[model samples]
Each structure stands twice: as C-alpha cells, then as structure tokens.
Target: MNHDSYDDNYIRGILNGVKSIAMVGASPVNVRPSYFAFKYLAQRGYDMIPVNPGHVGKSLLGKPFVASLSDIGRPVDMIDIFRNSSHIMPVVDEALTLSPLPKVIWMQLGARDDAAAERAEAAGLKVVMNRCPKIEYGRLSSEISWMGVNSRTLSSKRAPIPTQGMRLSLNRTSVGGGATTASDRAAKNRSEPT
Candidate 1:
C-alpha cells in the first residue's frame, strides 16, 4: 500500500476496527500533543495504553504506563508511535515481537520511516505514516467540521449518525465500550467551561 496519500476509507477502517491502542513515546505533560491525543482517544472509546520508559509503573488517565510494548502483557490492536522518524525502526522491530502482533502500525505526524513501514507492511500489518489517529477520527467523524474547522468534506445533508441516539460515531463504542448515554454527554458538557 502506498503511504504517500491514504484514502479516507483506509484510515476510517483502522480507527473503527481497532479496540486497544498502545501509544509509544507518550508523555505525562498535558500540554504535549501526545498527551492531548491520549486523553482524546480515551474519551472517544479506544483503550489507550501509554508506553514510556520514564513513566513506567506510573498512571495516565487511570491506565498504567508500561516501559515497552512487550510489557503490555496482552494483545494491542494498534501501536501509535510518537517518537522521531529516526527512532521508528526499533519500535517497529519491537512491535513485531508481540505474541499477537498489532493489526496496524501508525506513525504520528512528523514521524516517518519508509524502511520501517515497509518492514511492518511486509509482515502483514497495515501501516500509516505522518498522520495522527485522533485527527483522522475527528475528521472522518465530522467532529472537526462541526467545530467549524473546515473539514473539507462538503455535503448538503447533515452527516448521518452511525447509530441511533448517537451524534458522532466513528465505529467505536463511547469512551468505555458503552454507548454515550445522555448522562455521559451531560457530564462532559458540564465539565467544559462556558
């Protein structure tokens, strides 16, 4: 598959299908993009695991941070990398060693390694480079458009809800693998400042 320009369907599929994600190079600081991404994905229903050597045994959003992917001790459906381009290959190598290899290897924005991507794809894993899943999710789900961000998808009709009683559905269950009940949305609304 060409990594240069990915079709919307391919990105949507990965974001929809994956259940759990192990975020390599995650940071504890809230201001960092990775940290914001971690919080956002978790809010959107994906089980976001943080993997960072410095914060091993610590917690992020109530999920324990592991030193490495191998330390996760379970199958991770995807690996979202936040490291520099030059460091991607070793992370790919480590991802390959997992018992149930992740279905996808996603390199964060500004991070790309063609050789590593080729290697992972050769091993049968779907690869995405220089993209952020959180951004893709918001784009595909029309969240960005709703926020007036000019998502670039023009349609006369409002985007259809993926399911009944759901306003934005990206194919994953709400935050905890459950529907985004009215109360949940209400609480989120209350928490955000006016």
Candidate 2:
C-alpha cells in the first residue's frame, strides 16, 4: 500500500483481472493523454467507458461518452480518474455508491488524492494513485520497450512477432518485448538446443 512505489505484481494483478473500466474526465481530443490511454486499453480488449459531462453526445473509439460514472449503465471493473487531485474525492465518493462497486480506483499520472485513495480502500476497492494503467499495462507487457524505453529485463529466447501484429497482452513474458503465447513458448522450447 505504499503510494510512492508500486510492486509490479500489484499492478499486473489488477490489470489482468479487470475487464471493464470507466474513465472519468476522458477527452475525445486525440492530442490529450486520456484519449490515447483510453484507446490503448480498449485495444487491449478491455471494455472502456468514457465519462465526461462535457462530451455526452460524442463517442471515442466507438464507445459513447456518459456524463458521469453514475450514467455508465453497466458495471465497470475499475474507475480510472483523469481529473485533477482536487476533484478526485467526488469521483471516489460516487464510485462508492455503485451497487456492485468497482474493484479498483486508478488515478492517472499527476493526479493523486491520498484522502480519496483511503476512502476507496476502506470500501474494499484497490487504490492506485498517480499512475496510468496504460503505462503499467505496457510496462508489464514489455510493450514500452518497443517504444525504445528500457524495460530492465533480458532473456535468451525472443518471442515471435505474432501474425496478428503487435497487440499487447498482460500475459506476455516481460523480458522479450513481444507477445508470447503458450504455443509460441512451446515453439521456442522446441527450437532450443538440448
């Protein structure tokens, strides 16, 4: 529960477990951080809901925007807060009101509210502060290394470029920076010298 540095397993567990997410303060503008993060998660196969009172009529990545978390109409596994620290409490408060409360509350980069994190944790929700799930997902999947960022992992066996292209998955081996399916690992093992 150290808000300063998160263990990778803690993040990976949440990322791998959560299938649906509600992103509050999402922006449809492609230049905005929220836009790409939303796109990234959606691409990874998470059901992404965009929430912003200002853009209720618009859609991003084919998902309609809702005015608030309360309007999502479907249960989301996590609530990702893109709002400023000062505005986080209200979002956390609203999340606590959901019938089947979300399992996690994730505050994006540069956005943290210790008080909000505390309350959500009290309500049995896992709390992550000032971290972007997109970044976490990429780092855990070694997708960040594809962008030339060092992932601090090295391995003798490299993964094959999937015929489907570079879609990231949390299940990938962190060392190789490529998607590694069970069959891919089997192929690798078969090719290695005895």
Candidate 3:
C-alpha cells in the first residue's frame, strides 16, 4: 500500500477553515497533552467542545464536557481526536453520520487510523492522521522558539546561555513612572543570578 504525502496547501486550508473543534477524549487534567492542545486551540479562537464520557456535565476551560458526538447540538467544524487508534473507527462513523459532515478529522500525534482516515477522505472530509494541530500551527507560523535557537528574528538579540543547575534573576524598570510591574520583576528575576 502506498501512502501519499500530505499537501501543505491542503493542511493550511483545513487549519484556516476550521472554526469549531470537538475534541474527543479531552481530559480535564492540565498535565495531559490533550488538555494543553485543547486549551491552545481555544486560546487561538477555536470553539472547543470537550468530549469525555466520564466527565460529562463537567466544565473544562469554561466549556461543558459532552459524552458523545451525538449529544452536541451545535455544528462541529472539525473533530480532533485524542482517543486510541483502536477506538477511532466508531468516532469517525458518528462524525460521518451527521447531517453535515465535519470539515476535518484530525488524529493526534502517535494516533494513526488509516482505515478511518480513508473513510473520512471518501466522505469528502479532510483527514489528518498522526499529526498535532497545535504543533503544526506553531511550527508553520514560526511561533516555536526551539529553545530560542534556529531563527534569528525576534530572539536574536540575546542568546540563551546554558546555566545548568544555576538560577538567574531578571530586572526591568518602568519608564516615566519609575515603578516596575510584576512582570518586569519576574523577567528581571529570570535573567539575574540567584
């Protein structure tokens, strides 16, 4: 079986076109990857609908957690899956069964379902398997600092030196008022030696 390369324009178009996302298996826990990715998308203006059977009726990031796709009344532009590959077929089936099919079906990193993706593609939906949308967005837009390396744009002024186990403090003085804000103090603490 031959796998085709993912088109850059196709990926970009799906990313730009998506407005609302139904995140399946979204956990309320912040330590989870799904939680962070969900928060990131929500912060970036995507309407996030968390889907978790165990957490139904609970609120995550100010949005209610739904048990299943069928429970959601509003239109879903995309279904970003965080579930395992074994359980993905049913989710794809449900998404495709909707009156208006979702624009995209994105499988999280390390989660790949070729059959489900093929079904989605056959149903005229854009399929992204084994890809993290949040990572893609940051990478494509150059928002990823790579620990302040690689690109010499805004982060070229000062290089991040290896301090090993050493602690540093940063200081900043406010203009006109001569008072420093909390952020300024924090920044100063980060750059100065303890």
Q: Which candidate do you rate higher for TM-score, 2 or 3?
A: 2
Task: Give TM-scores for every candidate, taking all chains together and pairing residue i with residue i.
Answer: 0.81, 0.83, 0.73
Give the better candidate number (1 or 3) by TM-score: 1
Give lDDT: candidate 1, residue 67: 96
Residues 1-194 of candidate 3: C-alpha lDDT, one tens digit per residue? 22233444455577778888999999999999999998877876778899999998798989999999988987899999998889899999999988778889998876777898889889898888766887765433334446552211222234345243221111111122211255345544543556
lDDT of 2: 0.81
Q: Give lDDT for model 1.
A: 0.81
- Which 10 residues in a row give candidate 2 its minimum summed lDDT? 174-183
Which pairs of residues collide in candidate 2? none
Writing each residue's lDDT as its tens digit, candidate 2 over 71-146 gives 9877889999999889999999999999889999999987778888999999899999777888888777777777
Better by TM-score, candidate 2 or 1: 2
Sorting all predicted structures by TM-score, with the top scorer first, yields 2, 1, 3
Clashes of each: 0, 0, 11
RMSD per prediction, one decimal?
A: 11.5, 11.1, 15.1
What overall lDDT, based on C-alpha atoms, would model 3 receive against the true structure?
A: 0.72
